[model samples]
Target: MTDSWLPTLLTETSEEGYALAVRLSRTAVKLTQPSAEVRERVRADYAEDFGALIAISHVVATNFHTVAAANGFWRS
Candidate 1:
């Protein structure tokens, strides 16, 4: 076994990523409310941001799986 920081880093990154996802989702909901101004530019920006959040979530999930497999946390 080699001493590598990847596992620790991945754990921290996943935690922060989850926090970011939650915050982003809250902001998206607030922005999309009927009372909020839904201009074309704003709508486009929100869509882009939401897409980025989804990407981040995917990366975090992938990292978690990698870490689990590497640490022998999964059973056959």
Candidate 2:
């Protein structure tokens, strides 16, 4: 298991950047929750929540936006 993460969000492609964004959110959860058991316990809380899912998407989109800007909108 990787104990540490986050060495700049620089990614070579938009797909990779989007993946990183999701990873960033998951990492934040791990850092905050730290307990896998607790996280699992609350999984159902938002498992079928439409608003929660949208919020998650917003967070990922925001991170991807920054990455896209850094990559000059992926223009050639």
Candidate 3:
């Protein structure tokens, strides 16, 4: 895993930024909303973040592959 992506996640500072940063944040909130209800919310948040990260990573990796393929520098 690349450590470089760490800062990109940590640097987000807005509502949109929080949406991105929460994917990588170490913070967790304890719910006042009751166990069953809060459990669903937490699970959904995790699912959403995981999907977003996977999609973003896929796009980035695909772009890198395309660039490398075009350059022919990765041919071996």
* Most TM-score-accurate candidate: 2
Candidate 3 segments exceeding 4 Å error: 1-48
lDDT of each: 0.53, 0.85, 0.46
Q: What is the lDDT of candidate 3?
A: 0.46
The full ranking of all candidates by lDDT, starting with the best, is: 2, 1, 3
Error of 1 at 72 (Å): 1.7
- Per-residue lDDT over 1-76 for candidate 1, one digit per residue giving the tens place of the 0 to 100 score: 8984233422234455454445544555566674555554466665669787687577556655655554454333
* Model number with the top lDDT: 2
What is the C-alpha lDDT profile of model 3 across 2-74, one tens digit per residue? Answer: 6653343222224434344344332222233446766666666657687877875665555444444443533
- Model 1 earns a TM-score of 0.36
The parts of candidate 2 lying over 4 Å away from their true place are: 1-4
